[model samples]
Target: MPSPCSSPRLLRHGPIFFAAFLSFFVSLGTLPAKAVEPDEVLQDQALEARARHISEGLRCLVCQNQSIEDSAAPLAKDLRLLVRERLKAGDTDQQIEDFVVARYGEFVLLKPRFEPHTLILWFATPVVFIVALLIVVLAYRRRSAAAQLPPLSKAEERRLKRLLEDR
Candidate 1:
């Protein structure tokens, strides 16, 4: 019979034990809590879900790091209602987001559009990195070339020898 400390038994039982433990631990947060308030969400579940998805991607103008949907500030509430109203009016999610961005500037959209002004936001970092790499490469090459200079003249070597011997 295999010893108690054998590898096969441990390997076979380890993952099963760990998985059960994780399932038990993770289930602590999986239970449903209090239901959503009637005043909180609009009548339409799908529309409200869409609005939430969009709003979660939008920054609240008055709140610290809170999305418009989560923020209770007047501006956030206004923006949330505006999103729902725009959805009811049949505006696509992108269209509603674009409307909000146009009104509030790119700061409203968590991920700004990659247009002319924001193109630099996309390209400038890479360009700077490439230029810096090129400069480093040139500097390294220059340093290496400087280190590879020809030996000193025979006269200079003789003078050094004489100075050292005389001293």
Candidate 2:
């Protein structure tokens, strides 16, 4: 008798089982990890929505790449609570944001405002891309020019013919 691992039934169903397992993990990755706890949520729905919006635009200081809404860090939780508190205090979104910026510096904002200080951050990628594109064009032009061998002189053509005959 064959072992269970080598059974024809298992073999037939293995790929289907593997695909379902893979898809389950893939779906999990697509789901957002909301870190807001029950106590942090505001009683007012509109205020809660506004707070969530503000939180999404604020960066998590501990997880610099993730927004506060998506981050699970303690600091992110604090920021979320702060946003809700400000909302309860009847602060406009701008005021709440300004308050946070004043407290945490501009680094806490997920999207930094375009200003003289951040000009390089906004323009560097395009400037570097333009420079790289120019370099590639220049290199390609040089390679094309180099490959064209200026119509090898008559004497050089004769020398090539002689070498080929000798070979």
Candidate 3:
């Protein structure tokens, strides 16, 4: 009897399947992995380092969760170039970051600044985590306490033994 694993469909399509698998990864490898192009790199090493540092903390508006430095989005590329330009113009890292925040709001920052509006965003995770931990600990304690039975009276023990014996 032929095993189900040795299907005629798989044998017939095997070469095409292998070719497709190889080509998929090859196409992916050909794609530009980083957002920053060669032309975008600053001539001054110090300025470039500062630009990279600032970009690393800025969120890519297109990618949403990825930092501008790590994202391949066109918006991320623009932001990276903007950072380098700002650095060349003698802007401090904080000033450049502030300028971005002013234009894009706090959402552009990977680690949002703690301000009146963003205070909740800054503290909500820790507060929720602590509350959940407390609830879990309390629930565990209640379950364990309920599981700990009180000492049985001699009469009750004798009755239980008799019930078991009868069964």
Candidate 4:
């Protein structure tokens, strides 16, 4: 007998199932649309590209976590405009980034700069992992040591035997 999973009814709908699955994955593969407006775009391709590249690294202050390139926030729009104005003035990418950082502090950067204050942020995960590994190793060793001890004292063994006989 054929299994229910291999029934003609299910097989008839196989193409529909496959089409739905393919369309779902194709939609997922598409990138999220940017929120940049038409008027906001720079006239110069090179300057626009640089502006976009810089904007991608900037955090949207209002949105908290979204990059300026992706955010719909008013602050993100302003930041995008500011990046364009800086590009128009012939600022280098480093200079533009420094200007934004000086005005907004490091929190406005999508990727924070490495500094003495951020040393803890950089090293915390490894320190935690090593500590957890040591704890796990110590626990396993203690458990193995306890498991290897002799089963019982002679008196305890005799007591257990007496209990078993009584039962």
Candidate 5:
């Protein structure tokens, strides 16, 4: 009997099955996992939408890389609730953000404000890159200059000739 691997149908459909399997995982990766529970949803659609927007911009302190909207941590849920409460209390989006920032400090923001304290955070990478580039350029210039030997003096030439003869 032919093995399953040797079946004509399996050979014909192998690539199709493989592609389907790959696409399933790819789609899963692209879909955001929402941690919002049904009870946490507000009856007011506008308020809920604003809360979701705010949650998307706030980082989960426990999951440092994930937005609170996508995080399942208890702290993330609390933040989501807080945003909704602030919205219900007639706070503007900016006011809600300010309140959260005041409570949690700038670290809770996914994108920090451009303040004097954060200037170094914003400029550090570019400054380091420019300094590294300058170092590389200077090193390359020095290497090229060193590679080109000065014209040999007459005495040096004679000495080299004598060494070559001895060799």
Candidate 6:
């Protein structure tokens, strides 16, 4: 017998919807970004390509989850404009990234800058796991050793039995 979760309508529509949703999501996931303002375009295709690449890696602080390329927020628009301006002015990609990172702190870059400060973010999980494992192992060893200890004295057992009987 089919379970309620596996009925015919659900099986048919469920998979159709799932496939449609997945395809829709995958297609849309490449940031439905707007083209640059006609005025902002550099005369060079390489510069435009470079601008797109850089913008895609910079988060729009105002839009939360969207990159500046995909965001329509005022701040995103401003940042995108700034990026184009910088690119047209002959700034290298690293220089543009560094300038934005400096202004926005290390948080603006989609890929964080690897340095002493960020080593903590990368290593925090391992450090926490190691500490917790040590604690668990110590606890297990304590319990095991306690279990292996000689049984309580006969007198102590008798006293415990008497107390339980009274209760």
Best by TM-score: 2
- Ten-residue region with minimum lDDT total, candidate 2: 145-154
Candidate 6 lDDT over residue span 92-139, tens digit each: 999999899889877888777779988988888899999999999999
Full-model lDDT for every candidate: 0.83, 0.94, 0.89, 0.91, 0.94, 0.85
Candidate 5 clashing pairs?
none
Clashing pairs in 6: none
Which has the better lDDT: candidate 2, or candidate 6? Answer: 2
Error of 1 at 21 (Å): 16
- For residues 53-107, what per-residue lDDT tens digits would candidate 5 score against the true structure? 9999999999999999999999999999999888989999999999999999889
Ranking by lDDT: 5, 2, 4, 3, 6, 1
Better of 1 and 5 by TM-score: 5
Better of 5 and 6 by TM-score: 5
- Model 2, residue 104: displacement in angstroms? 0.9
Clashing pairs in 2: none
Error of 4 at 122 (Å): 1.2
Misplaced by over 4 Å in model 1 are 1-45, 62-74, 158-167
Model 1 earns a TM-score of: 0.56
User: Per-residue lDDT of 1-167 in model 2, one digit per residue for the tens?
Assistant: 89999999999999999999999999999888888989999988999999999999999999998999999999999999999988998899999999999999999999989999999989999999999999999999999999987798899999999999999
**Local distance difference test, candidate 2:** 0.94
Clashing pairs in 4: none
Give lDDT: candidate 6, residue 75.
86
Give the residue spans of candidate 4 off by over 4 A.
1-31, 160-167
lDDT of model 4 at position 98: 98
